[model samples]
Target: MMKALLATVLAVTPVATVTRLSLPPPTGPAKVGVVTAHLVDRSRPDPWVATERFRELMVSVWYPARSVRGHQRADWVTPGVAARINTPDSGFTLPVTHGHLNAPAAAGKHPVILWSPGFGMERTSGTALAEDLASHGYVVVTVDHTHDAQFVEFPDGRIATNAIPPVATPAEEEQLIGKALDVRVTDTRFVLDRLRTMPLARHMDLSRVGMFGHSMGGAAAAGTMLADRRIRAGLNLDGSFAGPVLEAGLDRPFLLLGSESHDGEQDETWTRMWDNLRGKRYRMELDGSAHLSFSDFQVLLPQLGLPPDQVEPAVGTIDGPRSVAIQRAYVRAFFDRHLRHRDGRLLDRPSPRYPEIRFP
Candidate 1:
């Protein structure tokens, strides 16, 4: 999301213009810990390649940490991944993530939550939400689909970048994006199957799993729920559904948290999904938010010193910090209600604490 802005500004904005920006701190009290695994699925071949017979993925697990001291802080993205988005020549740096490197997982099991980022967007883009969920005693995992993420750096020092091409027509757009969603559904399910084998398995209660994503990833969240029964609840952040997920609505709880312009009147996919839905649901719109506001760009992009005209279109007119708070609170509420069996008041109606949310 900040790619074009960084390229434009770095050209005329001068060198050594670095601002170390931080993701908003989680509201929960527990300290966060994170560890990553390089997972390979021998059952599926590389979706975007022919030479490879196995699909490879990079997965990060975040959980409540027993102790974060004496460990190095994790970078938002790996150095190799950062070089693709934030140019090294500009001397700019992303903030260290709230998670400490491979800190010990807190005692006892916690409900698991899986995150899928927007299409062609890296898994790191959802760090704010993932970290926040982890702090609240949830074992949250984020996945980077090789060849679909901005870039994925394997343990072997191999970097796989996005290879999806541009399309000209809506038909072509649907065909390409539909294919991507199919791959993401398998990716989501594959990650869930492998979660129990990770070191954090003792802290992960996969029985109470919930899933969510931004943009196309959000749509895939629903698709995966349909394909896999293990996913008990799902939510979509400012995204429209594709494929059978659009028509074959879920019986399990599903929440739609969308931006100002993403309504049933504007997008038929949402309308169909809402009408087809048989379980608990809420179609929420953040008044001042744009599509990207639902992602980390809501807070991260403003620090880049882009032109105001450029910034507004990306994250929207809402206060960046305010948007982040609203998203973090409501998202947690929905998951808490569905995954943990807690009664959620935030999803019941528009609260004064967050006036920007509307039920449509």
Candidate 2:
């Protein structure tokens, strides 16, 4: 994760003038529809906020929609969440998304892909990927882990910031992150349970479930797969596994797509997990990408006028559109192959179109 880089950049960079931005349109055929839900897991107490008796979550479900003609498009982040993260003077308005709000789901059952964002990042940070997957006939659930997310805006107007206990030492830091990952795994399972009861549930094929995440979320994806058999395949974008996931290993289909700095040879955790994999697995490195390149930051940062020096270190040297395209292709290819039983030869070998992708 680019945690250090983000902190450094945020601390030193001067706030710019406010400019409105829009997410790149999804490349798939279907128009995307999104709905937000407030889910509560009464079975468990929140690990981060002990004062709370139940674990509450805000989740957005993106799926193939009938049309985007009259429905209102969704905001990238709720005004409250955006205000909490960005200063008023810092020309950082949340981007407008391509998804229509509460549109009717398209007919027929579709595979499901659960998404989690980086630590202290909002679930909407994965909106680009979710929209892309929804356009391609998959129902993607993006969860905002209350307290862990930078800010979760509930329907009732309550906003929750990350409440994980602070650590004074590196060991305590690891422990805190480990506990956060555990909470994320539990959150994902609860979201899955709630999805089965939704009106849109009839259009979702839960049996073909998959999960993918960026940074800490990616770590959670691997951990969730190990903990839940419902996740038939998992993808990790620039994240290293921890705790039981790193120790117990995984036997299901998993994909490790990372930035250049932490490829298979560079990261021992990746090597260990790769070797322990018992089912179909693939590992790839995007040559020009950095940790945040797999995130919406790849596009958002540049639009905000962050210089190449600052953006490139955290994201990558690749053009934002190209980065998004490459990620969308590879991610969908993996899911299409494993969950839908389609031929994903794209995963079998490197493609000339994306010379930036390296397989080891």
Q: Candidate 2, residues 1-360: lDDT per residue as tens digits?
A: 344555553443545566776778999999999999999888988887779999899999999998777899998889776665566666666688989999988999999999999887779888899999999999999999888775789888898876766679999988888888998998998899889999899999988999999988999999999889999999999988787878688889999999988865667889888888888999999888888888888887777676678778877888888889999999999999999999988899989988989996
Candidate 1 positional error at 351, Å = 0.4
- Give Cα-based local distance difference scores for all models: 0.86, 0.86
RMSD of candidate 1 to the truth, in angstroms, is 2.1
How big is the positional error of residue 211 in model 1, measured in Å on the Cα after superposition? 0.1
How high is the lDDT of residue 259 in model 2?
92
Q: Model 2, clash count?
A: 3
TM-score quality measure for candidate 2: 0.95
Error of 2 at 240 (Å): 0.7
What is the C-alpha lDDT profile of model 1 across 1-360, one tens digit per residue? Answer: 333433343343423577777888888999999999999999979988878899999988999999999988899988776666566565556778999899888999999999998877788889999999999999889989788776899888789977776779989988988889999999989999998887788888989999999988899899999999999999999888888977789999999999999997888899999999889988899998887898787887777676768777768999888998898899899999998888889999989999999988
